[model samples]
Target: MTEAAACGIDGVDTGLADPPLLVADGVTRWYGHRLGCRDVSFRLWPGEVLGIVGESGSGKTTLLDCLSGRLTPSDGTVTYRTAGGETVDIFSRPEAERRLLQRTEWGIVRQNPRDGLRMGVSAGANIGERLMAAGGRHYGRIRALAGEWLERVEIDHDRLDDRPTTFSGGMQQRLQIARNLVTHPRLVFMDEPTGSLDVSVQARLLDLLRGLVARFGLAAVIVTHDLAVARLLAHRLMVMQQGAVVESGLTDQVLDDPQHPYTQLLVSSVLQA
Candidate 1:
């Protein structure tokens, strides 16, 4: 796509002045003869939230995995601009380097909190582990920060000693979030963060997520089947269908006046339900 088209998709006239925090250029992932995602491309600026909305089998999760370096694309590149202003293609980096990036500068929130949290460890330990990996060593400092994060996520600091396995699903998910954010990651990849929660719990968690993302000025790519979740947390929306981006623009514009037939159907479905 041309530069103008790219900028237009984002609904912003950045004029290519500032560098994007993350860039996915023609990112494609295939499972043998089956396609996962095809030729996905977009630019995510700092502090912006981009939501990928699609139904199951639409390949949003595959695109997210490739973008997050958890899966390698069959073709194309996922380049990231580091905190220090250096851009690197994530796939080209060494495994250790990519792991370091995942530990330090990036955070991933799995749809299932169990996948993200250390279920066997105390809540404090879960958060502090990330801090320690980022070079934090002072025991008192780590514990204190962990407690602070627990509170930030609306978990009682008194539960710091409890294992996540004992917490409610929503609480476990919040604990997972606290663990991820304690490292102050610049970019976060969320796969249906509130997908498994009850409606009331999802609302509270979604509010918490919105506040945290805005407060930290985080750049994030979130994949969710629920358009409501996308509407709440994302500044822009990318509508995926049959493994390709069918439409993308400012969240309100795309949802309110979708151009593509797939996007229109998605909106109508949501409204009719």
Candidate 2:
């Protein structure tokens, strides 16, 4: 049996499964005197997708940043289990080691492709860079792998040399996905990946994302305001309000029957929309 299966963390397991990939405890963050996120705690198991949903300033993004190690929480701890089965506190790890871990074992997809992709580089080069960082030295092999990932994300091999500046919004987002997934990271953090796309485009991108996430059995945490997105992509849901998680549970249960007043309001508003 594989290590994941041996640890009862099979890719098909739920968020409640054992041998969690990442764990956050009493996580709280503040921007100056303003609270960003407060008293957040959760576990992300292998292959589970957790959606953090809230309004623009509800602190979902702040919590996500803290979880992904981009921003440190003022209080609490975030620990990640390495692929080697070692648990390490993200904040306590050496800076270089943490950077390497993110580059190799983790992925982050930003709301803006410009933040994630190197606009000046070719699409192929963008993908190749990650492989190179992981010690891929053969130019031919890197380019070939890049081509495969492009196709995997439904981008044509013909556009391998095109810069992201030349692509459409949807296409740029797809490229960003390819670049992030090329290394086959175990955990991925996404922030409103489809928020800027047209409705139809968003639909297509979400479908693509769903397939890729399942295909790889990725452990993901996605932050978005759209309940529809959380419904489609996440197995579990976390509803944030005013820097606090007001509700969390299985997506279907929470969305169908929200217990928190704030969550009820959010759900009703989405339904009305």
Among all candidates shown, the one with the greatest lDDT: 1
Error of 1 at 4 (Å): 2.2
**CA displacement after TM-score superposition, residue 218 of candidate 2 (Å):** 0.3
Please report the candidate that would top TM-score against the real structure.
Answer: 1
lDDT digits (tens) for residues 1-273 of candidate 2: 122344465465533446889999999999999999999888788999999998999998899999988887999999999999999999998888888988999999999999999999999999999999988999999999999999988899999999999999999999999999999999999999998899999999999999999999999999999999999999999999999988888999999999999999988986554
Q: TM-score of each candidate?
A: 0.96, 0.93
lDDT of 1 by residue, 18-88 (tens): 88999999999999999999999988999999999989999999999999999999999999999999999
Off by over 4 Å in 2: 1-17, 271-273
Candidate 1: 10-residue stretch with minimal lDDT: 1-10
* TM-score of decoy 2: 0.93
The Cα RMSD in angstroms, rounded to one decimal, for candidate 2 relative to the true structure is: 5.1
For model 1, the stretches where C-alpha displacement exceeds 4 angstroms are 1-3, 6-15, 271-273
Q: Cα RMSD (Å) between model 1 and the true structure?
A: 2.4
lDDT of each: 0.94, 0.92
Per-residue error for 120 in candidate 1, Å, reads 0.9
